[model samples]
Target: MKRIGIMVVAAFIGGAAAIGGYKLLEPKGGDALSFQEQQNVLFASNPKVASTGAVDFVEAAASVSPAVVHIKTSYTGNSSNQRGGSPFDMFEDFFGGGGRGMQRAPRAASGSGVILTPDGYIVTNNHVVDKADKIEVILSDRRKVSAKVIGKDPNTDLALIKVEATNLPVVKMGNSDNVQIGEWVLAVGFPLDLQTTVTAGIISAKARSIGILGRSQQQPTEEEYEEYQRTGKMPTNNSIESYIQTDAAINPGNSGGALVNANGELIGINAAIASQTGTNVGYGFAIPVNLAKKILDDFRKYGAVKRGYIGVTFAALDADEAEKLKIDDITGLYVTDVVPGSGAEAAGLRKGDIIKKVGGATIYDSPDLQEKIGRMSPGDKVQLTYLRDGQLKNTNVTLKGENSVASTLKPAVAKNTNKATIDKLGASFAPASAQLKTRYRVQNGVVVTGIEQGKLFDSWEIPKGVLITSINGKPVNSSKDVEDALPATRNGMTRISGVGPEGAFTFNIN
Candidate 1:
């Protein structure tokens, strides 16, 4: 019995020593079991966790969805339907078009808009409500109200419309100039006729010009001219697309919708999609809210876009061009020509000069400069920085009005001659002289003598002395013919053919 008790004691001693050794060899925190328990206790008491990199767009979506509205437009049938089969024919058929007689029901189309004010001032794409006989805004609560277009600026593709509603939801505008790449954003719109949809994406790029907006002094390619002839769809005229490009899913009905940041602030107006299928293909473009805001302000104050022009024609500087011009950096716009008696010329900006900055913002390309000047009004002074002969120079330029030169040069016309107006065509025309017709080899045409600063003529780069020979295949012998061919209330596309210094050319104006 003594020996057995001694053996049991020895065994207990050995087990205790083994346990103590294990404890001594364990990690600093604790034994495996105790470490896990400690972790559980810590977690329970603290409860803080690391982020998983997931974004929650619910707040943004909710906040912006209420301010976005569904815009439905109706178009009446008349000579505007000259192209018997129309693009909206299918839509009209689906929505029930006008009756079999001349008094047909108005064809309907739908898009989206953003409410800008509480008393019912709304902002939307020009294409959305352009030429519509009636526009109706359907709010988030499904209350439909008739709206009227107050003003439109085709250069920026923005329109201001008003409704008779009170206490409406308005979106908080954000500074798009501060929007960063890869930042989270939400596109709120009625895409594909679906009820308001909110899609999230990150900004893919900035200061993108897709050539959808025709460049100044840019001649259309053969393919573009043929495509317009075949489709009867005009390219965007005086279109400004210094767009904030994104990968968001923007479809047909997304036009004129709101592009909100993660804070639910409006940063852009969803406009065009770069898709071959006429649907979202991961690439979408929006007019920056800053540009849109400028347009809105001008519309409110001047009843039109009070645009400021520097009167310089330029092109993007390439490496070769930069080298040829002895420029070390190809970061500025290469000034090919400067208009005489204009702000640029007055400021001593000459051809071969490279504009480096305007109003302190770095000028990266033509669109950047265009956007900067476009946002300012006549008589506004801008600080200009340019590289002249490889030397950096600075000057201040006071801008002039669109018709400043015309007002100075042209002779006073009789009341009868002034009877004809160009309407929204944004150009002034006169009967071409015999010498101009002989020089251009055109028998009959009208001369585009002057243009508005930010209008169709300027956007199309229709320079003065160019002869407009035809419109929509109809011969234009005088200003009246041109005016008649392009009626003020006409809708859809227009084919404008003219001859310039570059020879015969055509423009498809929308």
Candidate 2:
């Protein structure tokens, strides 16, 4: 059903492109075939050709069709099934909560992937196997095999996994940077459980963010949310503008699928879309093939995508903002804030520096800068030209991501406001695991696994991937211990602290 819905969307988005392909490619170079040749070609091309005739999509679709596949993943562990209730309660029971209780269950998950190499290298979304114990790929030929994780980048939501196989079908990638909006592209995938589904659309727009991050204060319009839909159909202005936006419909099962050009060359990975009603809204986003290649390189070399940072926050100035800033005829990223310790910081780059270009590519907005930098790893060096105090200046900055103290500032989303609720942090917590004892690694205090909407910790300022080192001045034994220690301070404020990428922070709650 999910796959089917995705397929329907692809058809709708591809409606015009498919029709266009039919009409434009239907005839061979406009050269009229001889009477006998016409009859032979007509019948041989399509079994049921309309009076107008039919375009042979076989060469286009078949050229890259077999390279697509489906992916399924499963995890091995009791935690998969355990509803991580209060660890304190579990502790009370575990010693003897009556050992006759329910046992933990196994966890299994599924997704899709595409073959990148004939040797069995498959690419898919990183979320598909971030923590899976076993990953399985089912090829177009219906052969299934276990795949090994090659590399993954969460920032880009892409993962590359490898299966030991021979003579595999591979999809050739095209230059996404060269693709233009309104260009024709096809989305090939197994949508809604349908095998080898194909849809079409034109690039609508490009480089759009869904505001999943709280960077911009402006609310995302329907068009703004199009990047996350993956319907393969969307509006203009939402795509990267660098995308080969098409009207072709895309859907859920179409994720990680192929978006190819007229030459049937893979250009982008069909990703998201825009829709208020959860269907195709004619808006979709795809990772540019060139950018994907860069991200893939990082994943293969570092096991994850590493984004280079310039430390300075930026925005492409519109005419209004440019006028307000007393600048004339400018289309470049306006610097907002230069992170104190980031790459931009060490280079003496200050806030409000208008970046004209990075490594020679014109940067018109933050997204452009992001895409450019994101395609690189920390410690990578690059040259930049910017306007500082109305003077055109040039400089270089080296990116860095492996922050030693980065684990100290991650936010923790929890219901407890008590500074001593370390025990409540339940879930996965790394860094500390290796730095601390094996017992302490698993016991790094708390890593809130799940949150209840109405729970007390729900109101607390908790962020994901946060590490609770210690609450108050005591050691944490279990979750309930923190709940019990939480001070009643809804009207009053309480102190809560944790660690993450930026270091450590302590704030008061209301």
- Can you give the lDDT of residue 55 in candidate 1? 73
Off-target runs (Cα >4 Å) in candidate 2 are 1-57, 74-109, 213-245, 319-330, 404-510
Give the alpha carbon lDDT tens digit for every residue of 1-510 in model 2. Answer: 999999888766665454444344445432232222322332232222121122445665897788888877666665542322211111212233333344443366455677765456677766556667788888888999999997876456667888889657666666566666666678887665577888766667666654322211112233422331222111111112233345687655666778887666677776555554444557666677777777665555566666555555455798988888777746888876555556777787887778888898887766677667766767788888888877888889888663411221122122233334233332322222222212122334554444445434565645444445554544443465445435544456545555433345565644
Query: Which candidate number maximizes lDDT?
Result: 1
Task: Give lDDT per model, in order.
Answer: 0.70, 0.57
| TM-score against native, each model | 0.64, 0.58
Predicted candidate 1 versus true structure: per-residue lDDT over 385-491, tens digit per residue? 99887689999998877655223222321112553547666777767543334334456787665677888878877765566899888888766888778753236
Best by TM-score: 1
Give the clashing residue pairs of candidate 1, or none: 98-105
Supply the global lDDT for candidate 2.
Answer: 0.57
